[model samples]
Target: MIPSFLVPLMGGSDVSPSLLTFKSLCYFKCSMFFSPLGMVPVSALVGFGLFDRGFPVVGHCVEIEIPMLILFIVLSQYLKNFKTRQLPILERFALLISATVIWAYAHLLTASGAYKHRPELTQHSCRADKANLISSAPWIKIRYPLEWGAPTFDAGHAFGMMAVVLVSLIESTGAYKAAPRLASATPPPAHVLSRGVGWQGIGILLSGLFGTLTGSTVSVENVGLLGSTRVGSRRVIQISAGFMIFFSMLGKFGALFASIPFPIFAAAYCVLFGLVASQGLSFLQFTNMNSSRNFFVIGIALVLS
Candidate 1:
């Protein structure tokens, strides 16, 4: 039985092992063995049993979508060098605009019954699985309305969460350093780093209050996008965050946006994660591989991981 406290961390780690470290893995393994999170996966598996089977075509689309989009972006940028023809504007924002246009077109096609005969196409083209839930749910209800009396504190469980939080902190520190470099900005000031860590703790508290059961951390994916797009403006990040919060409050809008096809999301993730992994490897420039200590550490980490 998976411990409940460790479940979320395990879930996140499963999504991307590239972001974790040897120490984190050791901690996770120890936590898993101790079983601090408590049979969370059993409940989750039961919940998943209620959903329809996922489509293989959607999985295939996800696998190739990002690379294809990256290739398209690169080709479009390269073709811009042709002096004879005036090409349409193509930049980071332009790419997003084009994606929005395509998403809208897909929805239109779905609505117009273009895929009426292809049920799989319709299923894979967009998502709206949560729309019904959101529409039927009460807006102002507290997510966890009842308290199970006084909280029973378990030292082992608390330690597991603490270990995960420490791991998250280490990862966030690396992200903070990497994000600025990717954005072509100076490394964050000491106070800024402190504040960032502090805010992450606050976010964790808020998540618990909101019943998310997950801790917050910097996204390597977005940092990688900063590197790929060459856009480092903090205002852009703030605005995007604002939009997320705004949309999250609008259930229908959020559900609609969530309905974006897997292929589209996967394409973006592929490019972003690839860039992130590459950027992480680029950090090796500062390390002397010729040194046996450094070589063994790096070698063993890679092999073990």
Candidate 2:
């Protein structure tokens, strides 16, 4: 489960999956809070069964998502001639088209049976040796201590973990703020923000319980996807979360996603990260950038970051 979260985080650290993943978390959170009953429908829609099998396509990472982007650009340009009322839907339609094209290419490659001859074509091809879903019970080797005992506490390790958690909180705060904006929604209320932070703490607790060395943090790439796709509905995000949990429980299902081609993900990142940058720039409007203090703060932060 930890690896599952970390895998996307690792991929996103270099690109923009962090935003995409964060957007998905917002969707999940919103759905759970406002539409708890929507879980069943969402689960059925985005279940692990969706990506059971697929062949890999061989190409430069950038090529995978470029055609989709081109399609979006062309569609956006064409839609400019339409009335304002129709423009929003048309823009969303263009995004949908882009997604369809990318999926079609992936499906085409898979259906072509290319992997039979070129196993390396798939991302994490080495995983073929592992079970699609881990069948062993997670607690098979677990045991409880026979007597009450005090364990030595290492202040250095405690402080290190605290530092990491603090950094994670800062990043998560930005993600929470950005997620709503990207979804075309208002910023979360104070209570909701507190809840989100509390959830992070809970996640860390669960990670420790599971013996994981590190804790989880929200992804920023998913948030970027919200801006690109303009799908801010919490119901959709809840469904995504459901899929993640469901897949983690089913080893084979999780493997299916792992098998996705790198180029396809990279292509999506190309579009998403652009939106993230644009969204970040939009924040400048609220600031008094003309002031020397503000200017230096922003400039130094940008350069250092």
Candidate 3:
């Protein structure tokens, strides 16, 4: 299952979904603690796809999303073939480039008043100027531990989160296994896997202390990005973590990204998530599909899922 590792915000709301993937991560920081107490209902509504106002807005976004999806595919394929040692940046950051171009295109439409007379939902979602989030957001804000209030624990919530943690463990296993294969590295040994899971658990515990609703998990979309860009550098992830830490405190910076139209993000997910699913299926080639036992195992796994 593709875990919505973070809450899906409508002011809402993915690898080749990676174009805006990083942006969304940062956006999460803006409201990281805003609705901590409201998480259960919000998560339930999102899981059920029952957003009262967001559904119509999301529908309006498809017009923008479809074109963005096409652009991602075209740019990714074109960059793959146009590789060169001196100009490798294009291929390494192809997803970002596609996202920027399409984002600008969407912004242009908003600036040109193309969405001016559209329905309110379309205007709210499709028009970049409508949100005015940047002006309203503080320039900088420091997030302190337990800033929302002292963390509370309940048996019901604890049990529900335990269920999510179990699923996250399974998802993390797939991501950890897949990442090395994509990067052309050996699979992780059991000890390394155990260490990774330990760190992830620590991260989750820290998120609770720091007032965020969710903990970190292996990002399947990022694994797909590694396969798509073919740039597997640990230093890159380290540098990004540094940036995430620094920019997360910049309230205006996070809010600016939070204002990005949801449809644009949806488009990116179409490409990145597809790559993730394709990569998962690619593993089947390594298995003995012809064997009855293998088929039975696959069938049972599918049914259970």
Candidate 4:
């Protein structure tokens, strides 16, 4: 999964159309998809993660989340009457504009002299969640011993800790909803059903067994995007995938993306993530907010978010 802030940027790369297909399928595509203010929470958390965890950790975006997610979204289509929306023109327009800008920026960033450093992200071993798995709280001790070693499960080094698999699963689930929402539609693939989710569990175990598993197939924001957009065509998403594979081998391409100034990336992400947050809030509008429980829920959401 990409960091909440970085998603807007990293997502912009490759065949833009295909990228949308994949993101729309992500459990949550945009942090702001639910609340126009959601970016506040999304950005804050990611910013907090960056400071608390570090950049590589914050910038990390795993390709692994796609296959596993597509498998699930394909089956979600089976649930009937799950759709809602008047297809707000503004939301649709906003979603396209926001995603395009970020995608374009990603292409530009990689096009220039920036993407020259194509160090394989897979080669380096990182701490659990890259740094997010740890915190500053002195009393907060890590109970999982699996996190203590390097990721060389097959090479004598231990495979990644079990926690990575656990956390990644949760996040990817979230991503499935986020991506489509940003586009102002419900994801498609009518065969989608609860039974399909079983594939994800299988993936989780295999990742552990192989020690190469990383990234969440579902994330809150990634899925949120899909809930908003309703576009879930895997074939369309292949375009972006083609570019991504090429970029992986071409250091210059990836570096170009890494070139944009932090300020620019921040501003761009702020818009996208903020939109994502609003979508979340809009979804909440369906609930009875007058109740204290709901009131408290909204209140806490505002305070923390």
Candidate 5:
């Protein structure tokens, strides 16, 4: 629901090309900016019992996640050659296919009672079917403005949220820069960025009014997807946004996706997030690596982040 409203809103930017040239310093600074954001999924993988108390753990979600990771990579590689006319459907949608296959496998395991005697956390994270969410969700529910309650503000919370918004802006900037490069387009001009930020602010306003948990920002991970699949059509994104909105109204539909095993998502993230990190580093080619100043700046930024 949040993404459905947010994506199109953010996409509605009025960008005008500029006659000015881009600066190398700007490229250098933006290059490694997304490195930290890219590694967030790796941290999530670790939290999913990949390691326990600093020691490696096995057979928790390791069994499922390892296979899922490998499968996604294999499918993506194999599908790269299989195309229909001009569109590489297999390659472009490899992520979806891999996820669907693995999810079905997990569902089979659940039906076989594989997790019946496991710990509560294991069952909760690995199970394909979540009866509670499905049962609790209505068949059709439309979100209304202030549906949760009337808006309230606090000085302390407002300050903290403002900090988060600042971070979100920085992340979105990196995403904006990366998207053009991934799509084989020229870097966005200053005016384009301003327009994007303006639209993002409007999306955030709508998110608050719609009772979303967080405001909208350009998704860093999806930028990686653009790099991976080589699909950069704005119409595709708008269609996806429409699906999100449709699913939001169908309560059970949303709950169905929520029930996908957590480890499966983690495995997918492993591939996607790694690509994001690499994409950030790829920008280094545009900078003067021979310069000591550049190295020092990169080191400091990475370390601090």
Candidate 6:
């Protein structure tokens, strides 16, 4: 129920597991969507379970899903303490609903008849062997509210995609900034986190153009690392990033990275993201949202659902 709103969106169908996975990729954009990474693994498991019960779309999603999920969990947690000024409840709700509606709209408009189709959105392109991507269409495709949209790689769309990249890179920047400090250094510089986020932006924009979302960084696991170590130094995280760069250079890393269990990461991430959000709420000056006036504002958000 944690993903209470998402269950019905994918629309269950009775079919073979492979077909289900195909359907999922086509419609859900699963990995490509770059959702929280936590919820995704869970949704895949559910889809797989459905496939086992004779549903469809349960192929190899779990194989490639786990490590990316772990990375996502760790990065999300690491950023738990970084607070942007809180938006009014009405604003938050508006943003959430608007995103959902846009996703919904995109899903329907691009379908081929009743079956969603996007052969270009496959996972075949994201493996580490590739050198790079120079276009932006791939990144836009990842926002797969529904996979049926006609995701293209034409250079004509680059202008609009550049704008999208600017925002996605901004988000990537935020995630990178929230990681652990490395080494014996007590804390790292604000610039280091800034640079980290910038890296995240560049990574995703390029990868996204290839119809992938693999380049984004930061993990939620570092939250548990944070809660245990009580350290938020940027130096330590930079060290960790260096290590990742090293491991990534190894050919086998991609295979090994893909084998971790999906459900494990998703379940842990669900808890981690909620905690991160709560920690953000802890930043409020008054910490007094229970008042009648506050309730009215919060209620408006819930009503949109």
Top lDDT model: 5
lDDT of each: 0.52, 0.51, 0.60, 0.37, 0.64, 0.35
Per-residue CA lDDT of model 3 for 187-263, tens digit only, reads 66655665676677666655665667566677666776887788889999999999988888898888877877777
- TM-score order of candidates, best first? 5, 3, 1, 2, 4, 6
- CA shift of 194, model 3, Å: 1.3
Candidate that scores best on TM-score: 5
- CA lDDT, candidate 3, residue 176: 64
Tens digit per residue, CA lDDT, model 5, 133-236: 88898999998876766555444544565566665555656677767777888877656765676677666666766757666767655776877788889999
Question: lDDT tens string, model 6, 159-188?
Answer: 444445444433333233223221123333
Q: What's each prediction's TM-score?
A: 0.63, 0.58, 0.76, 0.41, 0.79, 0.37
- Please report the TM-score between candidate 4 and the true structure: 0.41
Give the least accurate 10-residue stretch of model 4, judged by summed lDDT: 125-134
Q: Which runs in model 3 stand beyond 4 Å of their true positions?
A: 1-59, 83-85
What are the per-residue Cα lDDT tens digits for candidate 1 across 103-145?
6655565677555565565455553243465466444432441
Residue 136, candidate 5: Cα error in Å is 2.7
Q: Tens digit of lDDT per residue, candidate 4, span 235-260?
A: 64577568765665555445544443
RMSD of each: 11.0, 12.9, 12.0, 17.4, 8.5, 20.5
Error of 5 at 195 (Å): 1.5
Candidate 5 positional error at 85, Å: 4.0
Lowest-sum lDDT 10-residue window in model 2: 46-55
**Clash counts for all predictions:** 6, 20, 5, 108, 0, 27
- Evaluated at residue 222, the lDDT of candidate 5 is 78
